[model samples]
Target: MRLEFVENGPIRLEGGRFRVRVGEREEVLEKPRLSLCRCGASANKPFCDGTHKRIGFQAPGGVLEVEGD
Candidate 1:
């Protein structure tokens, strides 16, 4: 599994087994790829609808690493 925090855009996930849960509902992602919203402007919460581009959302994007992994 790999995750990419796109430059000034959504978070991209690929080649992973994952699940999404909201309240009492849960869904196992059927697709290997997904774009999750990082900017709070997306109408589709938790998913990217390309709203960041329209709203001029800015964020530092890159891979995050933990020490002593």
Candidate 2:
């Protein structure tokens, strides 16, 4: 799967299997596409849940840490 860092937003996951792990919890995703939370404002924790849009989340320009790197 390839992760594209979208401008001023979350990381977009395109096509692949993913194991989303946060502490002791883990979620397996086999979807073709998905958006991950980066603003740390989602009520859904690791998942996007679309809270970023409402909060007007703007990503600062810098190096982005790759997920599952």
Candidate 3:
């Protein structure tokens, strides 16, 4: 299982449990791949629900590269 932050998209969760909490509400998803909406415009809440595409949710606005040995 891995979690990856894309350049111009939501947080990608793969092969693991995806969980989120906001205020008194919490959500846990057990999908293979999911894009979490960070733009806070998703009607589906914890899930991306294609809101990022509608509102044009940009990434962190930087270049990030990770290398492992």
Candidate 4:
């Protein structure tokens, strides 16, 4: 599998099968691609519902620098 973080947006995942687990619910995805939320503004929890664009979220793509790192 491959993951690409979009600039100032959701995380893009594409490739083979993968699993998504939330609480007691687990699901296996066979789709070619998926979008995951990073802005914490998605009404749909782990999935991307384009709320980041609506909320004007800002984040850097590629390598992320942690404050204490």
Scored by CA lDDT, what does every candidate get? 0.85, 0.75, 0.70, 0.85
How would you encode candidate 1's per-residue C-alpha lDDT over 14-49 as one tens digit per residue?
855769997898888778788999999899888999
- The positional error of residue 21 in candidate 2, measured at the CA in angstroms, is 1.8
What residue runs in model 1 are displaced by over 4 Å at the alpha carbon?
A: 65-69
State the RMSD for candidate 1.
2.7
Candidate maximizing TM-score: 4
Residues 1-69 of candidate 2 have per-residue lDDT tens digits of: 567666667777786778888998888989887887888898876668887778898875333445674
Per-residue lDDT of 1-69 in model 4, one digit per residue for the tens?
567788999888876587999999999988898899999999998999999999999998863333433
Residue-wise C-alpha lDDT for candidate 3, range 7-64, written one tens digit per residue: 6567776765767688898888777787767788988766778777777778763333
Better model by TM-score, 1 or 2? 1
The whole-model C-alpha lDDT of candidate 1 against the native structure comes to 0.85
What TM-scores do the predictions have? Answer: 0.80, 0.68, 0.58, 0.82
Error of 2 at 30 (Å): 1.1
Residue 69 Cα positional deviation in candidate 2, in Å, after optimal superposition? 14
Question: How would the candidate models be sorted by TM-score, starting from the highest?
Answer: 4, 1, 2, 3
Instruction: Indicate the residue-level lDDT of 20 in model 2.
Output: 84
